[model samples]
Target: MRINQPQLIDSTLREGEQTPSVAFTDQDKHKIIQGLCRIGVDEIELGIASPLNTYLPNLVKEAKKITAGSCRLSLWCRCKAEDIAFAATCFPDLLALSIPVSDPHIQERLGKDRDWISKTLTASLQQAWAAGIPAVSVGMEDASRADTDFLVATAKIAQQHGATRIRLADTVGICSPARMTRLVQTMKEAVSLPVAVHCHNDFGMATANSIAALEAGADSLDATVLGLGERAGNCRLEEVIGYLALVLGEQRYHPEFLPELCQLVAESAGRDIAENHPLVGSAIFTCESGLHQHGLTVNPDMYEPYAPERVGGTRRLRFGEKTGARAIQLQLHKAGLRLDEMQIKDLVHRIRSGGQVLNQEQLLRFAAKCC
Candidate 1:
């Protein structure tokens, strides 16, 4: 499925931290919220609220204080009276309650019947409404694996109980892109509320599944920066933003600050940037192979789908076993120096021959020495 266009994009603050190993400190949270605002995200999920867990109230207090008016803040909760009431104290712009629609979670996780699940969700949603928070939504936890009739039945109940949206969580990350499309469309047709899709990356189809959900009538997505989340992760925020802007021709998000937002997330999550991760990965804009280097010299378009500048990156010439003289010359040119053919060849030969690894500072020092 293909997106017709993008409406709005949320950032990786709240859901991004859902990655088991990725936890953000209060300072990190402040930085991430500011960065998301800079990148023009319409919303940010702060965190989940549960008496079943501690720490959400203070996080909400800090998040609300940091973000600008342009970014709406949200919180997630379980579909229970206490959970809903616990979260409403924070006074978030939106409250999303996760309800188990499948027999497994309904029976196993909650130890309750389907009829009981419906009552729980409706009661929780009404509680949020009474608190003067205008927005309420329900997440169909493990919806992708659930029986269709049950999922739709749950969404209709949510809509009837003052929920303006329903989220389908591929909670276990087992959903395929096609299955995502079918399931999202099925629930979307069942209710008048907005539809949101949350996908995990277990099968490496999170982004594809998100786009497919949008194609099948989902109006919103749950994505994370650096694709940080439980297990493998959730839908990657930067990848989805790029695809929407470059491929789908939607400019709903601002691109000028993408790298800043990425950097903020990387620091907050305490994860080093992986070379091969899409979009925000350090190597995403770096060229190494001779052919790629040569083609990039002729036209960056030959090697890159979108200009690196759009994501706050400049083209990088990675000095390695595969680099050529053209790449060396380009790097030198950026340093306000020029190396003729023989000089360029020498640098490439040494780099390719495994003489030394070149970081930006090392290359700059070498260029200064030559001058």
Candidate 2:
């Protein structure tokens, strides 16, 4: 498939806030927005601006003062006149109005039908346009579950009402890569405006689906720092960006700032960065397996895809239960020690059983013991 350079729309401030017990202070917002700009993301979705939170107004005002055009800032709100009016007051670079498009959501959630959904979307778009909003987009909530024909119709309504873009949300994370690609291709054919994909990780496919969507002509994709959001959270910014850079040869984003960005988000969100999380995780670049470590000692590229420094991380050779004799010998050499094969074999045996790696001081004691 032909690769498309898709724009990343980070929703760390919007959907990310929906994570349980997570709220960003004004300072948190500034740090995250600044980091996103530093990493060169195309846009950032600020939190919903409707219902007028006590802090949101002040947050938006502060964001305007601090952002200074590093990236476009947009606000997300429901498809209602009141929400759009409140969102307009924030004066963001763009406005995104979310509307549910599935039959279940239309009939059960809102007690409305497809016609009502279309009209509500049209009316909301009209109101935003008349209010002189800079740019408007429609977010199709649960688009994966919506009927394909009805989904196209919804996109048409948004396009008719002056939407510059439309987002297809896999609200439940049920779509596969193939399904995501097909959906994006269909939407691209059906609509003239740019199509964006927003995926959830209920089935652990958010990142894969997002990549598939972009490969199939999606113009944009949504991600949150460390994948923070409701339930299993949204697509992870680090994973998607890493894949694009290391595998797909896309370089629109600055991956070097990922470690710092993840740390910032983790601090504010009260979330721990998993040691095994890709890219920014602590142990992603560390090797402990005997065979892998042996191969790594021979050549760093023997097992590594790209350098750890590429993402502002360091490569480490861990000496642990799974470590091999070569790894142990290497560590010993690094500590300025040498031993015969027999002595090294005895030490390796003890290490495998229970011997801990010695520091320089402990190594001196060990050398005296051997003597």
Candidate 3:
């Protein structure tokens, strides 16, 4: 069954900050929070709560004031008493306690066994609840590599411990969509709490995996603007939301705010938006291929998946080395100029030889000379 309305927990402030050399100042964080609120995200992960990160408490306070309960605010914490204590001070609506369930992380990184993880997780949850935190989500770090039975057992523990949600993380970005589908399905079947998925893009399938999870009845998905995170980043907020709104007819998200939201995050992250980046890219709507251009002129739906305006973009047809006669004639006619078959063919040849893309006005100017 398709999840018509999946909750989006935007992690731009949390996971996005993990990107190397990226930091959001107080003002930047507030602006981004407001931007995310305007886009109607169900929740916003403010950032991690740590003693060394001294600004989190005040940031969460200000974010709460800015959002005023319109959106739920969450904080990421390790499955440690200290982290849970620090997170409680922030007074976020939810605390996401990240625990490594994979053997490599549990046995090698922490040098502990499954018993230690359960003890640590149980203690952390008890600590958060004792501090009067409203909700908690158990994030299973590296769950993609964890044994399915162990994952289910861990999820059961989380549910028993009063976690409001269970988040499965593809920590290494290695989970395929098919595997992701089965994993989410299994987790959902095993637990009564809401299931969320967090995917990385190391293998470039984060968005696909997220979609598969949603298809398998995931209640929520995590994403960051521009997919900014460690080592290739997380699932992109724009790509997932775009797919939901445009493909599955999920209407809770507003695609129009994506361009501005992504631009804001990009600027703050000191990164440039790729021209061909999906959904929010500046040049995605610009087409130059002869066949595509001709098809667009004939019927835009033939080549375009959806209208450019759907995502606050404009469509542009440009002529270059691949320009065809029919496309050239159509563009010329639209400009109130009629070029015969021979003239159109000659113009196409000149455009092809020049090897530069020409807009409608430039093509008109070239056509005047050719005729």
Candidate 4:
């Protein structure tokens, strides 16, 4: 219920859209920004000014017009002068400069040695500072694969040069929670700079890794609404926010709106809400097992975590052929009919024998048949 550890939340509009097929229109992006600010995010990563920058300008222009001015807006970019040049046009509150710290990337992809990358990063940081921006953060493009000593040294250099925060980005999405915690601890011990996490979900551990990082000393996490990003995606905003509330019980922030945000991003990304998706999935709160249904009738807490009402999802009784007496009776009552235990039992037997999946119409028919 109480947490001494402080963590910053950067929301979905920016990093989330990196999902293979997700894109947010200006209106959609603005809506997310408004909600994220209301939800008390410490910072917002408004992913514009990419190599082919367009979203950043649109979001910044629109964001400047909106009134959710509580959180800082940060734009993500590669470690390039032109990207920084693009960022200066809007002069956002926080500018995040991303760089490749791994030797392989520095040698092959970046085509520059560590010395060059470090020098260029320092120059870029100074340029951002001179632009009169409030803060500049550094994001290591692939810290998971980067040499640990090299990563720490680079982070220290960035902090000395002017970066207030250093983000350990899981660029290839390859960090487990344990690795995340260890890396975060290493970074925390290495520099006075605030450490942040930008995890991708290629290995499906973005949220877990992010939580681990925060516990170990990360002050901020980069999350996209509904886990939308390039590979598997960054951590899902709703997932972590819910954990921070329900599991950690900080209660300072309400997490009920997470489902709404998930729907928005899912629509933007052209993905259906997977049935097993946490918290917001249609099946998360629905109970259908015969024995589980019997227990639920007495007290839903037997299996459910927080009540469905807590997250804006409804408690639902899914119809399954393996219906118990209490479950069958409950369904009969829900159907506005009263039936004896025998009638309900017989009905359950009939439904189970046919291997027939019941639809709404069929359920109604079964209810009426009991009449």
Worst 10 residues of 4 by lDDT: 1-10
User: Per-model C-alpha lDDT, please?
Assistant: 0.77, 0.86, 0.90, 0.78
Where does candidate 1 have its weakest 10-residue lDDT segment? 4-13
lDDT of 2: 0.86
Write the number of the candidate with greater TM-score, choosing between 1 and 3: 3
Ranking by TM-score: 3, 2, 4, 1
What lDDT tens digits, residue by residue, belong to model 3 across residues 212-242?
9999999999999999999989999999888
Single out the weakest 10-residue window by summed lDDT for candidate 2.
358-367
In candidate 2 the C-alpha lDDT for residue 291 amounts to 87
Q: What is the lDDT of residue 132 in candidate 1?
A: 82
Model 3 TM-score? 0.97
Shift of residue 52 alpha carbon in model 3, Å: 1.9
Q: Rank the candidates by lDDT, best first.
A: 3, 2, 4, 1
TM-score of 1: 0.84
Q: Model 1, 282-370: lDDT tens per residue? A: 67887667788778877888989989878777777656777677666766786677777777777667667866667656766765655
Model 4 regions more than 4 Å off? 1-8, 50-58, 329-344, 354-371
Write down the TM-score for model 4: 0.89
Could you say which candidate leads in TM-score?
3
